[model samples]
Target: MTTVPPEAERLLENEPVMAHFATCADGRPHAAPVWFRYEDDTVEIVTTGRKLENVRENPKVALSIQADDGGDTQWMVTLLGTATIVEDEAETDEARRRINEKYGAPSDAYEENELVRIDVGTASYRTY
Candidate 1:
């Protein structure tokens, strides 16, 4: 697995920005916003519905995150990775808390969502 660059990691961990998670299944692509936590070389997200279904069907995914101020872009990062669906209830709960904490939400928020960890294979970033 490729590691996220230091500058990109700092941006990801410091900003509470929404990531655009992308998945493709059966020749169709889907993208949606999600709250995420970045640690080491992995990006974690708790999600349900179409996003969850897409990941189960196809583990290949991508994520895009940007830091902006007053609608002006400052920096952006894009990650390409393979995703794993974490079925352990305990791990899911812990991941939920971490993600929620980053976004300043309640610890138990989105309890019904399943955890998906993306093992980043490629990471690229740019600053404006």
Candidate 2:
């Protein structure tokens, strides 16, 4: 497994930005801002239905976790990665906790639903 650098890790951990994950279908790219978690250089995000459907249609995707700032944006990481859908209860629970610590609590009341894990296949960074 490839390890993320400190800069990349920080940009991921505390940038306080939502990731816009893009999935393409029928020559169209669908983007969604989502909360995610990072563990040992691997990033994981949770989604219920739509994202799953998109992933099912296209396993390859591009992601960008943009930093929130006006002039001179803080940073942005964008690259390609192979997405694998993971449907493990224990893993989802862990994802819940990690996501909470990073972003915030889930919008809906807690209930175990069909959760998925997006493991970063290959991650790279770009600065402007």
Candidate 3:
């Protein structure tokens, strides 16, 4: 796995912005906004329905995050990675708590969602 650059990691860890999670399966692409937590070169997201199904079908995924104020852009980071569905309930719950805490939501939020961890293989960012 490629390590996330320190500058990009700082932005990823500090920004509470939404990430655009993208997945592809059978030539079709799916993307959705997700609340996520970034730590130790891994990104955790709790999701269900189409997003979850797509990840199951395809472990390869991408995440796009940007920090902006009003209409002005500050920086954007894109990550390409391999995703794994975490089936352990305890691990999923812990991931949920961390993700929720990042977004300032209740610890028990998104109880029905399953956890997916992406091991980042490539990370690129641009600051404007």
Give each prediction's root-mean-square deviation over alpha carbons. 1.0, 2.7, 1.2
Candidate 2 wrong stretches, greater than 4 Å: 1-3, 106-114
Highest lDDT, which number? 1
Ranking by lDDT: 1, 3, 2
Which runs in model 1 stand beyond 4 Å of their true positions?
A: none
Worst 10 residues of 2 by lDDT: 107-116
Between prediction 2 and prediction 3, which has the larger lDDT?
3
Candidate 1 weakest ten by summed lDDT: 1-10
Error of 3 at 104 (Å): 0.8
Specify the highest-TM-score model's number.
1
lDDT of each: 0.92, 0.69, 0.91
Q: TM-scores for all candidates?
A: 0.96, 0.79, 0.95
Q: For candidate 3, what is the TM-score?
A: 0.95
Clashing pairs in 3: none
lDDT of 1 by residue, 1-128 (tens): 44788989987887899999999967798999999999888999999999888888999999999988999999999999999999999999999999999899999999999999999999899999
Error of 3 at 38 (Å): 0.7
Q: Rank all candidate structures by their TM-score, best first, as comma-separated numbers.
A: 1, 3, 2
lDDT of 3 by residue, 1-128 (tens): 44788898887887799999999957888889999999889999999998888888889999999989898999999999999999999999999998899889999988999999999988888899
